[model samples]
Target chain A: MKVKVPKTLLTEHVALLERVIPTRSSNPLFTYLGLALTPDALVLFGTNGEVDLEVRLELPTEGEGRFLVPAQPFFQLVKSLPGDQVELGFGAELSLSSGSFSTRLSLAPDEGYPELFFPSLEGPAEPYPLQTLLPVEELLKALSHVRYAASNEEYRAIFRGVQLEFSEGGLRSVASDGYRLALYRLAKPQPFAKKVVVPARSVDEMVRVLKGMGEGEVALALGPGVLGLATSGSQGAAATGKGQLRMAVRLMEGEFPDYERVIPKEFPLKAAFDVEAFREALRRVSVLSDRQNHRVDLLFEERRVLLSAEGDYGKGQEEVPVRLEGLPLAVAYNARYLLEALSPLSGQAVLLLSGPTSPSLVRPGEAAEGYQAVVVPLRV
Target chain B: MKVKVPKTLLTEHVALLERVIPTRSSNPLFTYLGLALTPDALVLFGTNGEVDLEVRLELPTEGEGRFLVPAQPFFQLVKSLPGDQVELGFGAELSLSSGSFSTRLSLAPDEGYPELFFPSLEGPAEPYPLQTLLPVEELLKALSHVRYAASNEEYRAIFRGVQLEFSEGGLRSVASDGYRLALYRLAKPQPFAKKVVVPARSVDEMVRVLKGMGEGEVALALGPGVLGLATSGSQGAAATGKGQLRMAVRLMEGEFPDYERVIPKEFPLKAAFDVEAFREALRRVSVLSDRQNHRVDLLFEERRVLLSAEGDYGKGQEEVPVRLEGLPLAVAYNARYLLEALSPLSGQAVLLLSGPTSPSLVRPGEAAEGYQAVVVPLRV
Candidate 1:
């Protein structure tokens, strides 16, 4: 196989490679990226099995055959080369040549390369436009916060993945690390869907790749042990290149817990205030919280909300005026989760969907667009 | 204590506090930052006993007074408030008021705060201008690479400190963590000086603060358990604030190891090339260097060099042309240290300061300005 591709496009594959691929994989086979240099396109993939990145580029392909170089050299060659076209050749000897420099790299046997999966969107596949998949920015924001709540340890295999439930009203994503749980629900939803626990790493990589593509319709296909994402029409104007690309990754199999009961939907006492204002306030409050401390309790009244943290020395309380609903109530929460929920949101007002001595959901006004939830009341 | 100061200055103090104060100190006493809010100044100190930060802000004294508050709250409070002049009034209770926000923070007994030994940079203190101090940027670059080689764990208390030696010729800084050693020397000397082990933390913090400021005389004072750095003139014309202010901190005590013997003067082979060109090549080569693998084994021949790394499957190598100095020789090294030494200078050529084995010094051509050294050779 031989192909000449634009250096910039090839570099994009390198950029995504580092983000999706784990620096150290216990299995040596997993460390190698799958590089398929076709006649019309050069497709690059990097994954540790769980989180994979597949970036496709229509290299003017110049009709080359196919070859797969080891991840490191392939990435390094593309990254170091000058702008213009990078000529890649495969066969008896794999070679990446550009400008005055042409280096031949050793290739691994393609027989052991892990096969990526993409659920066929043909039969029984729900059809949804790119826009309908979910706004890239909003999804990125929700995933960032919820992903943090996933257990990074090997204590509970299932807890490591974030659970996502999609129904008619919207999509709810939940993650728990035993100690604390974070929930985020997008108010807008597709016609109908179910739930699944996606490996946290894969979702993060998918979000990072999609975020760079601007506003575009990303077709998503969900299935057992596998998932697929394909992009077509963009949000604003036509983005450069074909934009029709697919990334297929394997999913972790486990029993995701029922997180619905974890979030208290009926917040007895509600409060409304500027989202940024509250976010900044919570950030300040967090600084004073004990490094070992986890939640900040919210004491809500008719027209004021008091955020407080009790530590060894004393209690730290800050009150901000806010119009509330129902009787006065106080609910505790992890200040970090609260701050995370507020960070991505942008709105004039934030509505605290709370409950007495129960978990509270923090959602910004419609203008904020994004959604985030923090389960509180860990107890004093 | 009662006084009003600019928020910007207070914010700067907080920035310094965030780094100097460790989140948890072995001794609880070290956890509290000694705040001597005298009528004349606000002196704040945070130390892990190993590395300490004592910063004094001269607040115009109007009414005579004093107080001490918890460091974290004080930093958070001042940061949360708005406006320039922050009214800080205290007697039995400490109240810091700004704009419409008012926070009354409780203070710890001033007696509980430890008294820091503020060194006398006063008596007959000698001043070393830029001409003698070596380019601050050179010192910084050298420190950046060498500090990483220092042991993070203080198994050898003195080894954790960066040993900086001086003589009539110039200054050389050395740091090693048993596995690797990095030595950097300047081309020329500035007037007079002695040697001392400046704690890596102190050197790092000083470099960070120094980067913000310019070319001026940095008065040096080396005392028992102290190394004072006071840059008197404007860091540069583009510098900010009253650049005349001097910042000094104490250093660690002890005679550093004799490291000059570590750099061998003679080698069987040597090759010279452009510093940047070699650095980039080494960087690409480093993508495969792991603790388990000696990334590259370099061979120097007639005006040419070959760098090869043998992986689990096969071997890969790159040949670069250079200026040869001795007989052809081959040796292996951890590619990282070699890449680091190849950085930090401006010139078209680099002189390979070599030894018998892979242990060699990569001196970027500006030897008259600055120089760097690295010791390598383990498994090839």
Candidate 2:
């Protein structure tokens, strides 16, 4: 179909498609990006068996043509050509001629492209303000950190997935691989109360879409058996499964244990210090930490807090002066998790609330923004 | 031995070591970077089973201490730490203490460090005029044009490497992977006669050292079995094989095939145009190339270079005006190779010298700067 679309818009969509498109695969049909020319818009979908990516761009179309250009050449050509206007002449062979660069590239068969449809999710689609939509970037950053810690070889569902819990206080994310647990939470809007476990694959795609989301609020929809989340943007506006533009995420059907109970609520000992100071100290100490060692000992004494992690290799210790409350306590917790959780803390002051040899609640103080961590004690 | 050394220099050595060091393999010594400290110098050696690297710096020491540091934590900790001069305290723990950052890393047993004896080569240790040295940056820039053409997985050893042939004319470099070849030469060089196949890996490392070598010349020590080429700066110098202050290289022993046989010395038909103009056209036309069949059929007529690569997926073609000499010729060649080979050409005019269905010779006719390619004609 003959259409006139904004060059930047088309280029941006194509750029994102290029990132998600499968390159080295036996199925050339999978490489085809489907462009459906509608009366007032153009719908582009790039799917490679496992994931379906749909982006709907507003355009002026006089006639209709389905352009299934071979993904590789088209991306390469568009990237190489410096142009504001690209004339796409679709016949038996799709020819995209760029006026600016004086270049023309032909594409593969459009008909050979497999039909991609959004799976029929049982629940109704709910829209979320792209911003409010589960700390899009924040949650993604947290997931990527500890996702490395999750066990990959095991076929057990929860072991390879990240647990997302939205409760009375805010949102919490936890990932573990039996030996250690990385728990991260951000205290924000309080009304919601729900929990869902998302596989790494889903989290990856979510991270992909979240890349474009800015200050706008992202809407989230949690279904009975599935999870549907959409952000307001060109990416979020993509026409996905079936005819919908929202991404349909299949939530893991597995039991996520009570990570909360593992977090000790009452501590006879407590230590308060600068979050930045502690994070910096940990960064220094972590350098000497044994990768095989499970923990970094946090010793609380009068007017001082010591963070140390070392083993047969060597020892790294950082002592930061702090106001000690409750009682003196020395507990060992995973340094990796402490670093992961401390990273998201926005300000300087941090409250290291301990439950005497129990799981420690490392929460960002009132002046500090967001973020908290709960670490199960490690016997050094 | 305790002395404060610039962290950046130590970090730089560690960075290089990390890339070359391989863990968990035979030749366990390859994973350890030998640290030899005298009152005058601190020399570090990093070696993989395939490649070895040695760098030296100045640090005060009470006496000579030679040991190999386990590269993993040593490199990792060095990278993470931020400081100018870090106090190096090697005692019972061998700890590197900096403020809050302290790590006592394990050292690999020091039994197998290659005995590093400074090489006193046959070549005039009398330095080549610094101005006479190959402008490393220039050579590196030129090498990149053909480096990609070298086959990564070499079924045939020479084919997998870059051929550096030096005759009376100049330095001609040719790299290919059967499907295509990229041939280029620097016409302006002092008289030299010798031929060698330099490993692409060696070339890559040489390029890294050459990046800052502006007017500084590379000292050539043509050894009995190797090409020992070294570059020096105010700080130090490095090369291919095991050497002290000077870099040494081992030349390939096998004979490289006669590349001249495939090159077209005489072309009855020819086309000439601006080098960059032709390069841009090739790049644009290449976007239409199908991986299944990698060819761009050029139909040269009266005054235009009509490039076409058509197959099942699609067709890509571009036509640009050019100056031609002799009879008209039509031939097809790998578009990717043509684009790559032509990309480095910077002259105002490009000469496409062709014969009766022979491989086309692409060179800059009026342009004096060197680089020429003999593309084997493809049957359309």
Candidate 3:
């Protein structure tokens, strides 16, 4: 296989592939990225058993063949080249030459390269059951707000994914790690019949890719065991003729817990406070919180809330003013969980509590229509 | 002891003390910072056996006493306070209160606190043998260029410190760890009896302090076993009536090797190249270098140099143009050592090579009068 491509274009695609490729795996082939060249374009593929990413480049090429090379070293070498054009030739080895320097790198056999099967959008044999279109920026923003709540514990496979449910009202994304839960709702909804649980790792990668592309439309398709996301090679006006990029991740096969019942229905004790000010006060007082549990107490009064923490080392307390309309109450919680729950919020935030042991709900103060986060209280 | 001080001022001084205190130590007192309040000033002290730092704040006080508090927790509490003025009271426990927030932290006995002995700057009781005044910025810049060459190996005490030699000609700082040697010269020098070896850890703290101040003058006094650095507390125009800050580090007791012989005296092959370009090329090619050794080969021709590194994983090569004035040569060296030695250089860099096995000298191409770095080549 022989191909000539622009350095910048090749570098960008290789960087994307590197993100999906695992640094080490049981199968050595999983650490290598496959490159297939045709007369019309060059295709790059990277996978780590669970997720597969394919990027197509429309640059002109000669001769048709395939090769597998170590992703990290190959990417590093290509990125380091100083010339605008790079010439690549693949045989028993891969040769990359640019300007006055050339390097011949050893390649692994391509026989073991994993086969990537992208679900078809429309086909007679087998078609994806669900297909939807959404704005990349908005979807990514909503995912970022809830992804942190997903559990990192491997024992519970269902809690390790973000649940995406589409209905007549809107498209809702929900994630819970048992201790805390976050829910974000977007108004646009498609005619999807089933819910898709995207692995937390894939959600992170999606955010990274969409964030880099700025504003674009993503075509999403979900089948029985796999989910696919594709972008039609257009980033503003400069990326017109580039080939499309596709990504697929295996969906988790488990039943997600019923989170609707967990969210409190009524919040008798409610208080509204400046988001930034409350966050700052939590950060300061939490410094002295118990290292093991990170517990900080919140004492709500008439028009103010006192945040305090005590441990073997010392004790810290700070008072922040708030607009209140409820009876006084005091509750303790893991400061880290509260901080992470409040980080994605902006402007003023409202806190709703029913009792000391009951779960507390937090939402954006001015508008309570879109997002909500619920955190369990810890015993002091 | 009771004192009222501005939160920002006290926080800044405590930060300086925290840098010198060890996180954990065999002697528990080394983990605590000592605070002594007199009618005139409040003095903060922290020591880790090897280095001692004391900062004096001339704030209004009511009583005279001394106490020791854990460095990290105390600093965290003070930094988290919300009000401008903090009232501190010392008894069986240390109490820090501001506004409506207060914290009582358990304190260690002050009797175990390490005693700090300041070198006499004036008076006949015991005069410092060497005393000099220099701009803090200049001193820090020179130290930054050579400190990386100091060895972290505890067995070789001599190589773990930067040798400071003062004479009528200039103040020279030299550090070597067998593989490389760096020498920096400052023209403004004062009369001194002998050379002092300042530990690398102390040099790092000195740089941090000087860089934080931005611009100031440091009064340096060196005695037989200790070195004292004092700076008048003046930051811009707002800092007035602030007491001076003093820091002392115990000098390493050992015979330093003569590094003068390590620098190559004459070179048959010399080349000049753009510093930034060479650095970038090294960074790129070195990515594929061997994991253990990180060896990169430099092939110098008439007007260009080819940098290449090959490992079990892959190979990378890049060519950077340079101005050559001598015969062609090929040399291999650890990429990390070379990168660090060249980082402190600016603009054009001149490389003087004696042979493939001999030491190579690198200096600023425009003028080779102030600084020189010599690195020994490794077998490719």
Q: Each predicted complex: what DockQ?
A: 0.25, 0.42, 0.51
Clashes of each: 10, 23, 0
Superior by TM-score: candidate 2 or candidate 3:
3
Chain B TM-score of predicted candidate 3 relative to the true chain B? 0.91
Native-contact fraction for each model?
0.15, 0.57, 0.76
Question: Clashing pairs in model 1?
Answer: A1-A65, A39-A64, A130-A217, A215-A235, A267-A354, A295-A333, A332-A377, B132-B190, B214-B235, B226-B251
Q: Please, what are the lDDT tens digits per residue for candidate 1 over residues A1-380?
A: 57776677667656767676654678676667667766556677666776656666655455554445566556665687633777777766666666544566676776766766543334224332211365665566556767877888987898888777778888777788765576676787665576667877777777777776677455566665666676552221213543334566566676576665666666556677877666665665555565685567677777877776645433455667787777887666678766665665665555555554556666666634545556565565
Worst 10 residues of 2 chain B by lDDT: B236-245
Candidate 3 - CAPRI tier?
Answer: medium
RMSD of each: 5.6, 5.5, 3.6
Of 1 and 2, the candidate ranking higher by lDDT: 2
Tens digits of per-residue lDDT for model 1, B66-184: 45566666666667764566777766656666654455566667565555443333433333121234455666765775777776776878777788777787777788766567777
Query: Sorted by lDDT, highest first, which candidate order results?
Result: 3, 2, 1
Q: TM-scores of all models?
A: 0.79, 0.83, 0.88
* Per-residue accuracy of model 3 over A189-232 as CA lDDT, tens digit each: 66655677989998998787666555777777877788787777
lDDT of each residue in B295-367, candidate 2, tens digit only: 7777778888787765555666677787777776777777766666666667555555555356766665654
| Order of quality (TM-score) | 3, 2, 1
Candidate number achieving the greatest DockQ relative to the actual structure: 3
